[model samples]
Target: MIRAALTSNVQVKVLPGPSAVTTALLLSGLPTDRFCFEGFPPRTKGARSNWFKDLATEERTIIFFEAPHRITESLEDAQTAFGSDRDAAVCREMSKHYEEVVRGSISELIDWAKSKDILGEITVVVEGFNPGTRQFSVEDLVKLVIKQEEAGESRKEAIAQVAKANKVSKRVVFDAMVAHKSGDKI
Candidate 1:
């Protein structure tokens, strides 16, 4: 094999333009201060389903790039994982002449995706997990920790994950863990 080293001293710069990720996030009407960009979901159905499940506890808003053809399937899985009423937005062909945006609950988006033959670049924005929007009891929180632990996470890691996901303090999760283990009221 012949080895050749090539280097170029070139500085190239251009005006930053709007990207599909940020633009869709902004169009979603969700919080932008803390957000995460998930470039694209898994192509296979099983992997994509698991991927969505893993993001169930994410506290930051999520942005996903999706193809128009798979939008309906992805939306279905999203609805199953994030629940029917989770706030989300579907942006199609953003910034183009035929650009369209639909913002609503996951259920509504699912309906929209299934209603017609979608064509164009698609971006999906989902609101972050908000504990306030849904109530969880001590038992529920404890159960979540246990589930996380069962999913190959350490006890401590599971507790922390549960705390963050539920928007509760570590102490709360620890107390719940102790109460649960000792069969005492929390």
Candidate 2:
């Protein structure tokens, strides 16, 4: 019946699936230079929210695969956890049929999704932290470590936070801090 309608010149469209989503993600200006796709965070309210929270500060761009039925809810959850103003994109039914891409702040997309009953697969592209937005510097790290030492984080614990946040090795952070104090190049 559907094919017969199309044979009579009826218009039809196809939606792209995971493959198109992946390719679009690869091309998205975010930072596929290095990134990861955590397809669909948990569906449960509590677990899903926590997962979003965990990824809130991730410096790398993230691509998510979402079902149409859940897209609005997922976008809302992402806005709440990653900050409403967070940069993001939603591409649905990519290459084949009924393709649509909405790129904007998380809140903007959330509002857009809520206004319509979405259909087809969706891939969300979100911008990562802009370069040089990091609040801490080498000096700041040292100062924080000093404070942590006084409060309770072992030298090791303080160093770990520095490494985790900076995406460097603990030894690198330690050596740099020590060299800075001693007036030597690290």
Q: TM-score for each prediction?
A: 0.67, 0.60
Clash counts for all predictions: 0, 4
lDDT of 2 by residue, 1-186 (tens): 433544465543433345755565643434566666888878887777767856766878888888888888888888765667777878776774466767678899988998999888778888775535544456656865675577688888978875775556687779767877897764
> What is the Cα-based lDDT of residue 143 in candidate 2?
69
- The candidate scoring highest on TM-score is 1
- Over the stretch 1-186, how does candidate 1's per-residue lDDT look in tens digits? 000111132322222256888778766667788999998999999889878977876879999999988998898988766778888889888777777878789999989988999999998999988766766567877888888888899999999988876678999999988998899987
In Å, residue 127's CA in model 2 sits off its true spot by 1.3
Global local distance difference test of model 2: 0.70
For model 1, give the RMSD to the true fold: 12.2
Clashing pairs in 2: 14-96, 14-97, 15-97, 16-93
Candidate No. with top lDDT: 1
Candidate 2 residue-pair clash tally: 4
RMSD to the hidden true structure, all candidates: 12.2, 10.2
As a TM-score, model 1 comes out at 0.67
